[model samples]
Target: MRSMLKFAFRFIKNDGHRVTAKCKAEGCPWSIHASKGSATQLISIKTMNPTHTCRGAAVSSGPQATGSWAWRGKESAQEHLQGSHKDAYSQLPSLCDRIMETNPGSLATFTTKEDSSFHRLSISFHATLSGFVQGCRPLLFLDSIPLKSKYQGTLLTATAADGDDDRQNGLQEPICEIFKGSYHGYCLRCIAEQLVRDLKGQCSQEVKRIVIEDLHHADFAPNPEDFNASVERIKKN
Candidate 1:
C-alpha cells in the first residue's frame, strides 16, 4: 500500500486476505490486485491493469516533493561535511586570518563552541564599508527571501536605497535611477483590485463604466480640478 501510494495510487478495497489498489485520479483505469502468499507472510501481486488514462503527472512521495527540500539539503551537506571533511571546522580560524591578511583593513570573525567547534562566522570587506560610509545614503533595509531547497532557509540581505529612490549598488552608487518626471505610485492594476473589493455590488453599470474610465483620466489629469471632479463623480456613483 505504501509503495503504491508513492506512484499516486491508493487502495480501493483492502482485507487481510486480499487488496485492490487503483490510481488516485478520478477516472484513471490503472489498478492492481495483491493477495497473501501461500507459504509466506509477504503479499504477492496477483493481477494488474497497467494502463493509466489520467492526464496529470503522478505525485511524488520523495523529499524533493516537499517544501522542506532546502532544509533537507542543508542537513545532507552538514552530514557529508561531518563524515568526509571533519577538519573543515578546525580550519575556520586560519581561513579568517587569511581573509584579513589578503584584504587589509577587512573584518573577519568567527566564534566557536566550548569544545572549539565552529559556531558562527561573519566578514565585511573594508572597501564595502568605506564605500557605504562615504557615498551611500544613511537608510538601510533588511529583508529575507526563502530558498526553495529541500532544506529550507532564507537568503538574508541588507540593502540601501539611494537618494533617487533607486537601489544602491555594492559600490554605494545607484544602479538605475528612475526618470525625474516619471510617476511612480499605486499602480493601476492594484487600483483595479481595490476597486473590485470596494465596489463589488454597490454601483450600476453606468457608474462602474464611468468610474473605471475616469480612473485612467484622473491618473493623468493636468489640473487638480479635473482630478477632484473625477473623484467627486466616483463618490456620487
Candidate 2:
C-alpha cells in the first residue's frame, strides 16, 4: 500500500493465505497475486501484471524469503517509498545549527516531544528581521499555509507589504515576541476575499463596491481620524 501510494497508484486488495491485489482505477491494467507455502513459509508472487498506466512500480522477483529477489524487492520498495521521516527528523538539530551558521544573528528554535518527536519550529533570519525593521512598514500579515508532508504542520508566514513581497517561514511566535509594536493583522488579500463573500446577497453591487473601496481606504488611512472617516463613509453609502 505504501509503495502504491508513493507511485500514485490506487489499489484494491483481497487478503488471505493467498492474496490478490489490483489497481482500483478504471481500466488500469495492473494486478498481482501472492501465496504462502506455510504459515512460516516465504511468500511467493504467483502472478503479476506490472504494466500500469496509473503508475510505475518496481517489479520484484518471486519467492523473496532469502531476501534475494521477491520479498526483498517488495519490502525494500515499500520502505523506500514510505520515506525516511524518522531519519530526517533526527537531523533537525544539525539543520538548525546550519541555518544559524549560514545566517548569523538569526533566530532558530524548535521543540521536541519527550520521545524526541518534532513538536514545533520557529525561524527568523537576520536579513529578514533587519529588512522588516528598517525598510518595511509596521503592519504584519500573518498566515498559516498548510504543509504537505508525512508529518503535517503549518507553514506560518509573516509578510511585509510594499516591500519586496519576499516572505519567510516561522513567524507565529517571533512576531509576538520580537516585533513588539507591529500590528499582527490578517493578510489583506484573504480579508478582502472574505469581505467580498460577506457582502454577497446583503447589499447591491454598488454597495459592495463602496464597502470594498472603503476597506482599502481604511487600511491605507494615515491617521485615526482618516480611518474612522473611511469607516463612516461606508455607513453613509
Candidate 3:
C-alpha cells in the first residue's frame, strides 16, 4: 500500500478493534483505518484517503521527488500565516495604511472585534475599479467559494463581462430593493431552461418551437415596441 501510494504513513491510534494510519507529513489531514475481517489474520481497509493534498517534498525524501513551485509557495505561505496569525492581526492597520499610501485611489477596509482581533477585510484596487468603470459592461456577477485553510472562511468575488465576452474583475453587493424595479432583465438561458422543464411531455414540438423562438426574439428585441409585439405574438401562438 505504501509503494502504491508513494507516501510514508505512521500508525495513529487504535480505536476499539480498528487501527488508523495517517500520513507522516505535518499539517496533512490524510488518514486511513483498517480492521480484522471475519477470517483470522485477514485485515480489511474500512476507510482510505482518496486524495492527498501534501506535496512530494513534504512526503518523500528522494532527490527525484520534486514538488511544483506553486504548491511549495502556497505551503510556505500557509505555514507563515499559521505561525504569525496574531502578528498579522496586530499589523492590519499598518498594512491597510501602506496599501492606500502605495496605491492612490485604492480602497482598503477591515473590521475588528472589541479585543482587536480580525473580523473581515476587503480591498478594491484602483486600476481594477478604473478598468471596470471605463470599459466593462454594466452587468455584475457575484459569487462566494469556501476557503480550504486552517482558518476557515469564504472568499467573495465579483466579475463582469466586456463587449468581447472577456471576464473582468469588479465588486457588487446584493441589494434586494434594486432588483424590484422594472429595469432588471431575466436571464435568457434561465427562461429557456424553465420553458423546457414546464413544457416537457406536454406541448407539441411545433408549439415549443414557436414559444421558444418568440421568447428569444422578445428578449433580444432592439426596441420596446418590438419586444411588446413579440410578447403578444407569443401569447397568440
Candidate 4:
C-alpha cells in the first residue's frame, strides 16, 4: 500500500545578510530538500535608546563610563555650549585665543539689556553623505538665529531646505565659515564668495546648488546691491 502526506515549512531565523536553516526531520521528503542549508546574514544597525540616544556604541573603559554618559561627562548642554566645562576649549581654540589675546579690547560689546531688539536668522548646512556617492551636492537651510555677545551687522546664511520647510530636515550642523561683513553689498559679496569656496572645498568639489531666502523685509536687513553681488559670485563659482 502506498501512503502520502502533505508537509508545511517556515523560516526560523533572519540575520540581515541571509536566512538560516530548514525543517528538522528524519528521512522526510522536505528534509532532503533542505540539503542546501542557508547561511545566516549579519547586519549592522544603529539602535536608538528610549531617550533618543544612539546605542551599541563602544565606550572607553579607562576612567570613563559606557555610552553617552562618558561623552556627556558631567556637564549640561547649556554649560557645554557656554564653555563652562573643563574641555570646552581644550585644544583647537589655541589659535583663536592667541588672536584675541593680541588684539585690543576696544571692540564694542553688546549688553543683553540694550540688545533685545537685535534679531538673527539661524542656518544649518550639510555636507556629502557617502564615500561611494560621488558628485553628490551639499545643501543648507536656515533656522531661527540666536543672539550673541558681539555683532558686526552679522548676516547669517543657512541651508535652503531648512529655510523653506518648517518641518524638520536632516542637515549637518551649520558651519559658521560664511559670516560675511554685515549690512553691506561688498561685505555680503565677500562673504558669499568665501562661502562658495568653502562649500566647494568641504564637499570635494561636489556642491552645485545654493538656496537663500530674501528675508530682508522682516528684520535687520543687508545691503541689496551686495546681496545681488554675493548671489552673482556664488553663481560664477
Candidate 5:
C-alpha cells in the first residue's frame, strides 16, 4: 500500500502465496519475487535483481525515485508513521507551507486561540479541488466528525455531491436558537426516514410504506387542493 501510493506503480503478480514485481521500465532488469508459507504466512524473498538500467526516473514530469531511493522511501514511511503528535502540531505551519509548495493552488489554513493553542486546521488539495470543479457538481456534503485523538477535536469535511446522512438532523436545535421565529424545514426524504424509524418496531412494513408514499406525494402535489387531498389521503396507520 505504501509503495503503491508513494511510487504510483502497479505490481504484475501478487497472490496469497507468491508476489512478483518488476521495475516500471521495460528492460530495467530490476525485479523481485517473494513467497509466503502456507501454514505460518511468513514471507521469504525468493529472487531479487537489485539493479535499474532505466533511461531516467520520471513522475508526472517531476523528480522521481530510482535505485537506492528505495531505502529513502522506507525511511520516509517510518518517520511519518512514528512521528510525535505534539511535534506534528508544533510544526504544522511548516507542513502546511510544504503542502502548498509541492502542490500549487492547494489551500491550507489554521486557527489559534487567544492563548495560542491550536484551534482548527483545514486543508484542500489542488488535485481534489480541480477534480471537483471539473465534475461540475452543484451540491456539497458538509459533515463534522469527532476525532478520537489524545486531544479531542472535530474534523469537518466537505465533499462534492456526496450521499446524505443524519448530519442535518443535528441542526434542528441549533437552528431554532440561532434563527428566532423561523421554523426549521425538512425535505421529504428526511421526513420519510424519520417516519420509518418511528414506525419500525410498532407498525407493519405496508403501513410504513404507505405513510412514506403519502408524505412524498404531499410534497409533489401541484396545487393547494391537490396537496390537501394528498395530506387527507394519509392515515394514522
Candidate 6:
C-alpha cells in the first residue's frame, strides 16, 4: 500500500505538476485536494511553464522520513501558498500601473465609452497631409477593428503608400486609434496635420497627387483646404 501511494505521488508530483522532486520517497503527495489541514485552498490546476515549475528545487514541506514534518509548523500549507500568490498579484498591478503612467503613447487607457471612441488616426492623417504639395503623389488606406464590446468603430491609418514598399502592406504596422464622437471633423483635421509631419520626416520629396478611393462617406472627401490652412498658420512664425 505504501509503495502504491508512493508511485502515485511520484507520477503526480513529478509529471502532473512538474514540481521539483528533492526526494520522492521522503515526501507526501502534493495533490491539489489531498488536504493540508482544517482548511483547503484550491490550486488553479492550470499548466505552469516548465521554467517556473520544473526548474526550481521542489518545494520542501520539511523532512517526513526523519519522523518530523514541516506541516506541523504554525503556518498551514494552504496559508503559505496563498501568501505567495498574493505577493505575485500585488506586484503585477504595481508594475502595470507604472508602465501605463510612464508610457502614454505606448498604451491607451480609457474608462468610459466616450474616451475609447476618440479618433486618433483622423488627427494623424491630417498631420501627414500637411507635408504634401500639388506635385507629390501619396498613398492612403483605411482599415477597421472590432472592440471587446459590440460597437461600430473606425481606425484611421495611412502609409507612404508605395507599391515596392513592403512596410505599407502589412496589418502589423503602427495604426492610429480612432474613436466615435460628435467632433469628428475636428479630429479628422488633426489626423491630416500629423500625416504631413510624418511624411516630411520619412521622405525628402514633397507629395503631389494624393491617391484615395472614392469617398462615398463625407469624411472620405480629401479636403486639402484644412491642411493648407494649417500650413499657412505654420508659415506665420
Ranking by TM-score: 2, 3, 5, 1, 6, 4
Report the poorest 10 consecutive residues by lDDT, candidate 2.
57-66
**Superposition error at 229 for model 3 (Å):** 61
Query: lDDT tens digits, residues 48-79, model 3?
Result: 55345676335443334333322343333334
**Candidate 1 deviant stretches above 4 angstroms:** 1-86, 144-157, 163-165, 168-237
The TM-score values for the models, in the order shown, are 0.33, 0.38, 0.37, 0.15, 0.34, 0.18
Scored by lDDT, model 6 comes in at 0.35
Q: Which pairs clash inside model 5?
A: none
Question: What are the lDDT scores of the predictions, listed in order?
Answer: 0.63, 0.68, 0.67, 0.33, 0.67, 0.35
Task: Give per-residue lDDT, candidate 4, residue 212.
Answer: 24
Please list the residue runs of candidate 5 whose C-alpha ends up more than 4 Å from where it truly belongs after superposition. Answer: 1-81, 162-237
Return the candidate ranking by lDDT, descending: 2, 3, 5, 1, 6, 4
| TM-score winner between candidates 2 and 5 | 2
Per-model tally of clashing residue pairs: 13, 1, 0, 8, 0, 33
User: Given candidate 3, what's the lDDT at residue 237?
Assistant: 68
The lDDT leader among the candidates is 2
Q: Encode model 5's per-residue lDDT on 191-234: one tens digit a residue.
A: 78887998879878987788788888889888899888778877
Candidate 1 least-lDDT 10 residues: 167-176
The per-residue C-alpha lDDT of model 5 at residue 14 equals 66
Local error of candidate 6 at residue 142 (angstroms): 2.0
**Model 6 residue 152 distance off true place after TM-score fit, in angstroms:** 8.7
Pairs with steric clashes in candidate 4:
17-41, 18-41, 122-143, 122-145, 140-159, 140-160, 141-159, 185-226
- Tell me the tens digit of each residue's lDDT in model 4 across 61-166: 2234434342332122223223342343243245344544555331222222354443332222123223113332345454544533223344444333333233
Model 4: worst 10 consecutive residues (lDDT sum): 1-10
Which is superior by lDDT, 2 or 6?
A: 2
